[model samples]
Target: LLLFVYESDASPIDTFDLGPPNTDVTVHSAISTAELPNTTNTDLAHVMKLEQQPLTTCWPGRVLYLMASNFSDKQKWVACLEAAVKSIQRKDTIVRTGMFSKTLLELEGSRRLELNCSFALCKELVLLGADEGLFCVNLYHGTHAIITQLTGFKCVHQIVYISSLNLIILITGRERSVVTIDKRMIHSRIDQANSAAKEETNPIPHTVIEGIVGCTVMDASKCHGGSYMVVGMADRVLLMKYNSEMKSFCLRKILLTRGITL
Candidate 1:
């Protein structure tokens, strides 16, 4: 496993381990180097050329976020957030068009076919709009829906996972606050509005937390079948506990000092 250590004024430091649990951590400095070439690129290029294709392709919009979901078999699927409408194109056809074909054609005929294929958007989405409000996308049964808007927050820092309750907790750096959204509620709303129109609606959030002040770095990890979260603020770290009844997290302990500032 890899461990990342971040300092307030310095670049992030990383350490890697390849041994058992008793192994001591071996720290390594970050390497600033060019990307290594993929071993399969040569084979891919040959196949593309044989199929009369182009070597490069581009997506339609600016990508805002990307995430991966792992399966039990260790396979992973990627989810992307783009500024505009998202679509998937066939790689074979994309190469044949030299990376610029908006439409495809049959080799033996004059018929034209569009290469745009619409897909369902990802479920656990957090879109930070220009207004600094978070717009969440909830997907269920192959349908996409929007949940509640998280306003009065700026610069969403990170999302922590709560595996026991299957919840996603969002932390904000601007407000030094945290909020939790009910995953089940989002799924239920999508099911209830399955056949309805695709208009946006505002639903109440599970919980909203505030009153904390400063820039904060939040981190979470699962251990011993439970989740523990740590929030590093100006001078100290705050420990929090996930409360299933409240559907939000509560601060359990606060380590305070007077020497920390943003």
Candidate 2:
């Protein structure tokens, strides 16, 4: 048969005629465009001017650089691409677990800080112990301000909060003595100081822990919801228990270590 075909859609299929068959005729099927792989280069430099701040896109095996018409459009494109990357990375447990590296709040201070160490008393409050003095900072406040300062101690290294007795123990580095402050007294003084004048010369009243030489590490059971305390010195470890009668902590047992180091 003899076949006539038209490439344009303006002509109907019935307009073509099929004549008597001829043995010399040959027919071939068409190859689909979808079956062919894209071999064209997708480089942004070749597509547009290089000064447009193009963005690079990445996948498993293929990479493409996309260009935007303007700078604002480029920013939007970059933001969208970053969001997509974060969405995929979040599916990984290890990656999601370590993603919180952003800083939420920063400590602000007016004077020069000589901070040696710090301790978190609760979710909102943190105790900063320094050579200058001890400061109480509120973390959730708008300003993150140091609400109060307790003077009378220097070279403070470690701080412990005892909830049972409402006491705060301060351990000075290399000092043989420790300072104890009552939480009730601290709160009362804070209220008074807010309306009263600032006193720089007078120091706050605190109990002094004496007779312990070279006090290095001091931990209390109050830290663990107990009433006992353990103090590690240069040569010995003292086990002290709280005495409710006198409203103070007293030495209950002392283990001396002459040949062993604390």
Candidate 3:
């Protein structure tokens, strides 16, 4: 099994290949756009473009998935994928240099961009306080844009994956309680904002995780099973699980360790 990860400016996408080793898995290869029309291999894969800009604070980008194309004629498609790669690389270079002056307010002001946030999944950017928030410029439209904001006025720490339910787990603090929101809600907010500019409304939907097990400024949260979320504090990690059988989150386990400290 081989896993390929791709990182844009913000989040990462990961994909895996499960096949016999060295058995000609060349169908999935990451190639640049300039390498098109030339044949070095037969198998062709999907092409992906970095959707977000790179962070300036030195945080490395997340690795996404392996290339997989839906087009016919894998070899020819590979050529197209190469072309996309070159285009993305060129665009990324320009975006990185341009992001310095493009703050969220400036982008929103000139473009009428709406902003929202959530914790359930990893966002391309987080909009902080009044001055510091995420901002993105429309290369295609030449407009400045800011994505949605999280429900609870807090900063997102880490996002965890729940394989059993196929849901993203979020960890946020500096505010009371943890919250989870569905990805669909984000789309709805964006659509609503676009349709109704004069309507004074709350854009993002929020579900708060109540009943504090413990508190810490810097901590990591993990989902175990059911509705339970385990939080790692200074000296211990508390497991908070939802007993669907009971319809409420409950503390299930507590592990103490020096290294496990969040």
Candidate 4:
């Protein structure tokens, strides 16, 4: 694919050739580096705080997702990575470039962000897991703003949206708990935060998995469109199944690696 990094759509800065597609399909499936298994391992302390800046968005700016309107489009998540890199690179250099934005959203103190996941149930909102807690950034009114900040979670590592179940899964860095939140509740909270009579609401509806003070959750994700969920921890990889009868997540099994010391 040809990637064009331009000041504006009318003016082009540079073009990058991404070479020939590996297959005729154009886009390839990939996995994140963190998901790969390795012998080496280290664990974080039980008590550690993270620092971060406010949430930000670059939807149509430097970072853009060229998604086909059709839901079945195979290139739904395939985007222009090289073009975005060049645009941001120019801005970081001596060149006074305005290819993108600095911060679409801002807040007090450093909002050290750990992980972020997007929610499309209602409006376009980004759920940011940070040192302070869980923060939601809304993309409406032509502004990216921190709508609400949910406390209690000292360090949140991952947040995943389960569309089929209409659930939001939160993984803590130290607690090793998977908290479940209803999508409707989040929508209500964000809506209330934007209204005249603002009130704080509990975003998490129930504790799917709890009281595991042993291991820390490293990462988590949903599969089969929320039918199943998986979490990686310091000690083991947990495979959780969604119990439709109970309407909660239940630990199906734990896969642990044995460490060999010579």
Highest-lDDT candidate: 2
Candidate 3 lDDT score at position 200: 24
Candidate 2 has its poorest 10 consecutive residues by lDDT at 16-25
lDDT of 3 by residue, 23-78 (tens): 11222345564544453333324443222223554543333323344535445755
Candidate number with greatest TM-score: 2
RMSD of model 2 against the true structure? 20.5
The lDDT per prediction is 0.42, 0.58, 0.43, 0.51
- Measured with C-alpha atoms, the lDDT of residue 46 in candidate 2 is 23
* Candidate 1: clashing pairs of residues: 53-95, 54-95
Instruction: Put the candidates in lDDT order, highest first.
Output: 2, 4, 3, 1
lDDT tens digits by residue: candidate 2, 41-143:
3322222111111122232221233345555666665565455444544554453354445453455556556787787766766677877667766577645
Candidate 3's TM-score reads 0.39
The 10-residue segment with the lowest total lDDT in model 4: 44-53
In the order shown, what is each candidate's alpha-carbon RMSD? 21.1, 20.5, 16.4, 17.3
Clashes within 3 Å, all models in order: 2, 2, 28, 5
lDDT of 1 by residue, 74-150 (tens): 11111111111122233234343553444311212322212211112244443332223444443331232334334
Query: Candidate 2 clashing pairs?
Result: 1-20, 1-21
TM-score of each prediction: 0.40, 0.54, 0.39, 0.51
